[model samples]
Target: MTDDTNCIEVVTLTPLAQRFSYRCRTPLPEPGCRVHVPFGRGERIAIVTGSSPCPEGVQIKDVRTVLDQQPLLPKALQALLEFGSNYYHYPLGGAWATALPARLCQGEPLPTPKPELWKLRSDATLPQSGWGLRQSELLQRLRRGNLRMTELGSGDRQRIRQFLAAGWIEAARESPRLHETPLTLRPEQQQAVAAIRAACGFQPFLLDGVTSSGKTEVYLQSMEPLLLAGKQVLLLVPEIALIGQTYERCVQRFGATAVAVYHSGQGDAERLRVWERARSGSLSILLGTRSALFVPLARPGLLIVDEEHDPSYKQQSGWLYSARDLGLRRAQLEELPIVLASATPALESLYNRQCGRYADLRLRERASAQNIPQIEILPLRKKRLLGGLDPSLLSACAETLASGQQALFFLNRRGYAPALLCHDCGHVPHCRRCSAPLTWHRRQARLRCHHCGWEAPVPQRCPSCGGDGMNGIGMGTEGLEQFLQERFPNIPILRVDRDEVHTPRQLAERLQAIRSTRPAILLGTQMLSKGHHFPDVTLVGIVDVDQGLYSADFRAGERLAQTVIQVAGRSGRGDAPGRVLLQSHLPEHPLLLALQSGDYGTAAAQLLRERQQAGLPPLRALALLQAEAQRVEPVYAFLHAAQEYFQGSLDCSGPVPALLERRAGFHRAYLWLESTSRPLLQQVLGASMPQIPSLPGARRVRWSLDVDPQNF
Candidate 1:
């Protein structure tokens, strides 16, 4: 017989077919609480998913402890996870792992954050006259009065450490709350704010604004009314690089105590603290990257997705999922208002707006009253270029720098050269693991694969012809940075790329340098675009943009348009009017011409028509069954099994090799299923997929299903 009172269902970070039933000493712990439950060899930390009935003849072990005062993930978020896991076709274990911080997964206790107070110790003697400048200055600051450590900035960490170690300072716990002055909203911004404030239940709004249109200010103002009502808000940005600046802006307006920033870059302890603030109902706002979507909210009143079109929102590896899609699902589940703000909104969101699923909020003018940058396309045909730099562009950059202003060179690609070619044999070095050419990185003095992160030292000569005719081909951010440095010797060139800025602190430092008011050049990959606010950068030059026009990927045009708009928007944010020089071999491409219209509405309409005709996403649903194995035959067999099972209902493509046929030594192939009817597609998946694992060749290879696949 089943012991209903003693049995509880627990979920761990394991790919289980279903939740396990465990015996508990007391009344089943709250459904969302963290419990230490016995697994194979040891105890594993797990979320108590729900109650269960003990099965006959089963020996279930008792849970050791309930680690939370309450459920870490509340009922609302739990419902969200359930829906997202099923929708994305991700395992419940992996989905939940993504929800909580790494520390919480190790069966450790989620701690309560103590109030931080620092005071000069009562037993400490006055420092002698021999103190160094750093110690001396720190002591002087401490002598003023007891200080709250929260008031300290980034520069104060080292000093605070020294003081605490020397017994010159002591910390005490104190409860605190905070407030800050709000910026005045313009008339149009007020209207947008009014609309957001009036949102009652399950409302989704698209804050469609141009660059420097003060959309952020609107986001802040809209949050104000909700914060005053003691409600929490979630603000999601596309990248970790943006979190520091956004955090600074939020802390300045809401006060540090009211705002919390969470991301993977943060240490486990720091992430846990942010989670504690969010869960305790003390934080008014939680701002961070995609994973921030899962942070538990006690009173989530609104959800805001900044740069909603960004590709980073889609997790390409390990339980591929889209945060933007989940955000909408969460809002609908909670019946809360959600505002997806984007200077260049995603086509999916645009399609929804066209179909009346989302209300559109537009901010057309620049917030500073500066005119949008005048864009001039410089054709790369038959022009005398100085190391890939058109003389005209250089002259403009010289003028901008001489006038004590900044110029930003935007290149989406990183490394020194995109490829290394053997002129003698016409051979190119390619990654052994992936079917892609290796890029030559000059600074690292190596050839690297951008796709799979494979790298090797540059060869002495061509491996094919042995002619010593190896030549660097194509331009990248490194090549642009080097050329700019040689031409503009006096001005400082700050190169911001993945290679240069690995941490958030590095990003913050580079941003700080740009704000110095000195004339300097900013060079980088897509990282320099969109998120940053560079006021004095009056001249913006896109060294390379021709590549995105005709990519194999269908989303290329939309992504390229967003990048162009965002990169150009970074300039002219200050009092000075900005100018953008775009270099392209094909100057009059329809997509490029459409950009002159300013907003993406016209281009979006065009793309939508094309997508509808072609039966793509937003008009149709897609699921990619990707299979990989050391040997390729099993992959094909497994996918063939899946295709045969779905048979006539869903249209399946491939069992063809992937774009990069082999990645990390595994040959990959994808089976794509598309359908105009979503329910029919879901029904087909629900009907026959459970039996595939036990089928022939299924165990010989690793495979996953990506529902609504964002990438190939």
Candidate 2:
């Protein structure tokens, strides 16, 4: 017990930015190790962030017990977390705490990785000749050698369990068996891979390729050399649904032990295994969504963000950090090459490319030289819509179906309808907990608020008019599927959305069904738009294109353009040339025109120039000071004081209400801050962190500072 290691600074996985001091006895736990320490009334297993000698006049409690034998977070990961904490203006404790699995924080011992091997046990009796073929086959498979658990399916599991129960088998763990799938790359893909390999350090490359341009192939090809070196690669996608195909592909190419998945969808034990694998450098690739960026790697070689522009990459709640942005910084810190591949790049990334911050690698030609989808703009002026589908677009879908080809109807909204309207009084149903209308889910027979997730049973009569003439006003994907079913009667229509597919297996089954069914009509929301290749689909019909044209948010047009191109890109991947029919009320809309001509680059360029002239992002930096309360006045008062706190230091916009002003029973408002310089804006926010929470009405509301806000 050295006097020099007498006290320690602890950081809990909580919102408090303040670090706590605790006395330590004997050998102190190193930084990044976990310790169970007394918090307010109970105990919390906190991370040891720093340590020093005991203060002269302080009385502090000692750390109860060390929870880890070695450091939980690597040095590089700790440094990256520090940078993220300062940059996002978030509490390091919260980010650091959330980085560990929930079980680890709950004082549960870290779970050990289970050996995936099973074999026949010694001294076990052999089955007699009366064994069934299924039992015989299982025994024969294990007789040859111990089989990896990943090599068997769910049905095979029962057989293996029966064998184990009969004292015929035992489990074992060993080094991960290595395997590699051979592949031939196209000329352009080869060049992209070579360029990435030749990079010196901290080089950012934008794989600005079109959808179905073999970007994944290029990513995999580039990783081949690094995987052979036993170095780890970080692959980030936008959503959990997208992880299935990518994970399967990675595991198939490099064996099951070589790949580990990190995402919120997995259970605690599963996530812990991946965390252990990542930290131990046993994983060749750590694949996941936004939160996986915090996972420490033993030997990181490359970072790849597929669909970098997708808004899902931005964390919305506690830490409003961008995985793509952090990946760039992480690569710089680690001196590794990174790739940001997207069909429609974000305006910020594009601006970075324009400024030469990122090398623009454009793979113009599709791998197989498949023809680009032909786009047609169908005007909806004076034309009646049946479930939001234009007559011309409907006819095109029917023709494609008759020709034994698939048809995809891309509509970004779910549920049966947007609102339940009363014919008598022109009244609409609204949510009590939110300042928004409740969408009608026909299957559930309920009105659901998309903003706050509050649900209500469908009323037999309109509340306002006390009339039974309640009608659904706007059609959604659910209603579209129902309508298409009635129209076709003979063909199958499958709807894909958050409501339909809640699991990876469900989504995989839906996709597999779509592949097997020809002349089928597929209806869905944005879930079907990103990173999906349906080669059999020869036609695409986009409904409700006007919804994004009049959005209050500035980035709506940019997002719409990206989605339009991505949805259109889903077609024409097969041998036959495909076409996309877009139904729009404003036929001449610039974004529509860009999509009609199949050129998103022009739209992105124009949007960037518009942002520059308007003193918005990519030109002038911005941060949002958001506060919400159960009562409205406290929110406005707190924001007004915050605006005053930054009066001359930075320019402040209104203590205005949010787009959806009141959500989940909280009245929200924000003060918009802008600056020509990024550093100055960040400095202003950092300076105000202490004062904003101490404002007169601060304790009455929930508040946060969103740096580089993606939403309005």
Candidate 3:
């Protein structure tokens, strides 16, 4: 037998499942350590997953170098990575690469910040002249005493910078104490907080509260104990915009140093800093988007997912992991409590509560005893449209403005027009690469494809028939914004959408602007629907609600109902009663009727029953095996092989075209794997995935397996 030192071999994790062993000149490193090792003739950053004795007379190469002084991933995270790899049937190394930030995977150095607190100079005094009304009031407050330089707003910053440049003000550095007073929670919020705190280990609590019901206050209160005990809290918001909003609240309650924000929109260095802080126990609270679920907390105490039912929680690509689901899993694994707060929870989550998997905590009454929004469904099937706004909606907007309240016009689509059609030829402009129509962006003078992001200058004449006249086929936010601007020229109109609010900073700025101006009209897509507090908005206009009534996707109706209720709920948040006008072709639809009546519970129950009868999710688990190839045959052929490989363990269906079959030059197809039992589906996938790589044209195709898929 060889000596123990001589037996040392470097086993590197490859994109493939099998770990290849190499000779180690130095001692074998621990698992999770990044090593520079020879792969063929070149070197690669290979993570050491294991080490084993080589076979007799088998030649091996030595590791070139160790990339890190310590293991980048901890043991628990390593296990989670392994679980993701096996469950998704993806390459182990590829899965690990996906779990880490791109900067870390690329071996970038972490950032070092020399934080210096800035204080108002002794010579500095508040400006007494040449200021806007708002700026003048703010300066008057500052005249009482010197404040932190960082505490000023953009407007204040500009004024201060001007003052400093003119020698009217000065700057100084001093250590500043971070402090904030806790806001008082209403009785219902207090009760909700009490119930959440009472729940001990591995409990799932659903905090059912309307907008401005003080859910955030309750969350903060429940988190205080965890923070005091030196434990970390994971706070997940639906979108990056919400991340900033939630982070601001956390900062208000727990100071800026105590909270770190994480999301894709942040710089790599910022993400790395936050990651390190969370892992090192410097950050007690992490406010982030969906990916924050993977952040390594030194001592995790609580997991909170605000707006738990938001579709943004479901990742559309890569591993397709649902952050909401992963949050609950992490809580269970760590034996910690988790809270899912939502005004309208997804039917699946509601079912979990019904089945006793989650403790239901209800905040039935609004914090300030504000009444629910009064909803009115305007039947437009037999009515003539005036710029997609009915008389009732127009009159309501006029009335709302007359009463000195804000009005919101919610249109889900975002372009100038959804499609451009030739009136004579009955033909519409379409994207060459994607199986979708090109939308008209009149402001940009372009035809854009939303799906594949392809764009081109809009042609003045129709390409199909060389006709000079072409008409926009459908209305979008741009059209609504223009129409509203024309109709209510005297009223200030703010349009919020992906196009208008391109960044988190922009979204925050616009939100701040809207809050400051209470009598403005807000028009946009789903961005105005959820997680925002608009106390002054007393009117909501849903431009169209018929899109989901006949949608092909099974969950469309449910999502539509949730979105409508959420948008409408934004109204009537203050003292005066509010009103919502829903324009729909199918005014008598059951879902619309339920939503108009503010009966989400009844709607959710009905949806759950339908889902159960149809063998949908929550009753039956699903895994989607999707394949894409340049040629359609390869996709179908591979899916058929996978279907055969699964055999009897799981029910297989579809070698059918995906929702959008041809996208960005690839033909896509999917195979649905269904099983009442997760273990059975897991077993089937475990057996079948091994045979996929050897299938014909496998190298030319890309594929992914989505377990418990939220969308198809």
Candidate 4:
């Protein structure tokens, strides 16, 4: 007989078929608690998912240890994980692993943040002679008022400890001070704020605003009511690079102690501390990147997704899931309101608004009173160009710089050039691992593969023909930077790309330089386009646009449109009027002409109609069964067999070669399953989870199921 009450279900941080049942002690631990249990030949840290009956005729081992006094994850977060696991067709173990920090997964105890405040003693005698430089500075600062330990420097820590022991200082537990000063909102912004504040439960609002249209201000003002009610708010950004800027803004509005920032860039200890503080309800406002969606909240009230249209929210690798989609699910589970704010809203979000599933909040005008940037298409046909720079565009840049304003050259490519071409044999270098060209990085004096991250020193002679005639072929950010620097020697040139900005600190420093330096030239890739406000940048010259106009991927047009509008929006954010020049070989392209009208709604509607006619996403559901291996045969064999096995109500496409046939030395192929009904698609995909793994040649190759895949 199965003992249902004494058995608990646990899941480890591995790709397993299902949860395992383990016999629990008399005092049962909660579902979200961590448990140490024995697996096949090893011990693993597993999460207690729920209670289950002991399987008949199975040897169930007893759990060795319960790591938490209370559930580590709250019930709301647990529900979100469960929904994501089933929706994305991912295992619970992998979902848990992706959601929590690495330290927590390794059985580390929850971090308790005990902040100490230090102040000078009232009756302490002066320490003039014996103290070192740091000690003297610390005492001098403490004479003013109390300071948090975090405010002290590393060298001052030892001196503070000594001073505490010597009765020269006193310490107490620190408390957060809430000093929220809400910005004065315009009428439209006030309307948006009111809509968010009036949300009773599980409401979704799409805050559709143009760049610099005060969407963030709406977020800040709406959060005030919730924060005052002693409820925590979660704000999810799309990038780690934006966390520093967003964190600074939040800290400035709500006191430093009230706001906390969490991301993967921080150390494990810091991440765990933030996680614990958030769960303990000590944090009022928590800001983070995509993964922060899983952070537990003791008193959840509202969820905000900034730049909701960004592709970064979709996890491209293991355990594929959409943070934005799951954010909505989390809000529903928590019975809270979620605001998805974006300038160029995602088509899915727009569709939802059209279907009346989401409330629409629009901020039509720029908050700064600056006019929308003027868009002009510069025809790149039969014009004398200087190293890919049209003379007219160069003149415009010079004019902007000469007028004491900044000009930006926006190119979505990085490195020096696309490939190193040999003149003697007309040979181009390609990545040894991927079937892609090697990019030439001039400053590094190396050839790099953007796809696989492989690099090699620039060769003196062509590998195909022993001739010394290799040169870069196409223009990239580095090449454009060099070309502009040579032409405008007097102006300061700043390049913002992955190569130049590796960390958030570096990106912050570069942004600071752009703000402080006038009459500067900024050159960068798409990293520069994500809601960065460059006030003095009056001119934006799009150096490249044709590459993205036509692609095998259906989302290419939408992505290109978003990029163009976002890059153009960076201009005219300051006092001066702004202008954008798009250099395109095909100026009459319908997409460009639609962008020229500056009506994204109309363009999006047209695209939606086309999608409806074509039976794409937001109209129909899609699930991609991806298979890859070092060899081609196994991948095709496994996918073909699985395709045959899955043949049923849903329409099944070919197990065709992937967009990139070979990447990182793996031969990739995919099968697309589509249905008009989402529930039906989910049903079909959910059924294949276990059966497909046992398909022919499945063990010889790696395979995964991507539900609502963003990439092909």
The number of the candidate with the highest TM-score is 4
Which number leads on lDDT?
A: 4
- Report the number of clashing residue pairs per model: 0, 0, 0, 0
Local distance difference test, each candidate: 0.84, 0.86, 0.79, 0.88
Question: For candidate 2, what is the total of clashing residue pairs?
Answer: 0
lDDT of 3 at 105: 69
Candidate 2: Cα lDDT at 92: 90
Clashing pairs in 3: none
- Runs off by more than 4 Å, candidate 2: 1-4, 113-182
Per-residue error for 460 in candidate 4, Å, reads: 1.7
Candidate 2 local distance difference test against the native: 0.86
Sort all candidates by lDDT, best to worst.
4, 2, 1, 3
Error of 4 at 420 (Å): 1.9
In Å, residue 599's CA in model 4 sits off its true spot by: 2.7
Cα lDDT of model 2 by residue, 467-521, tens digit: 9999898888888888998999999988899889989889999988988999899
lDDT of 3 at 495: 86
User: What ranges in model 3 sit over 4 Å off?
Assistant: 1-16, 55-57, 109-181
TM-score of each: 0.90, 0.91, 0.88, 0.92
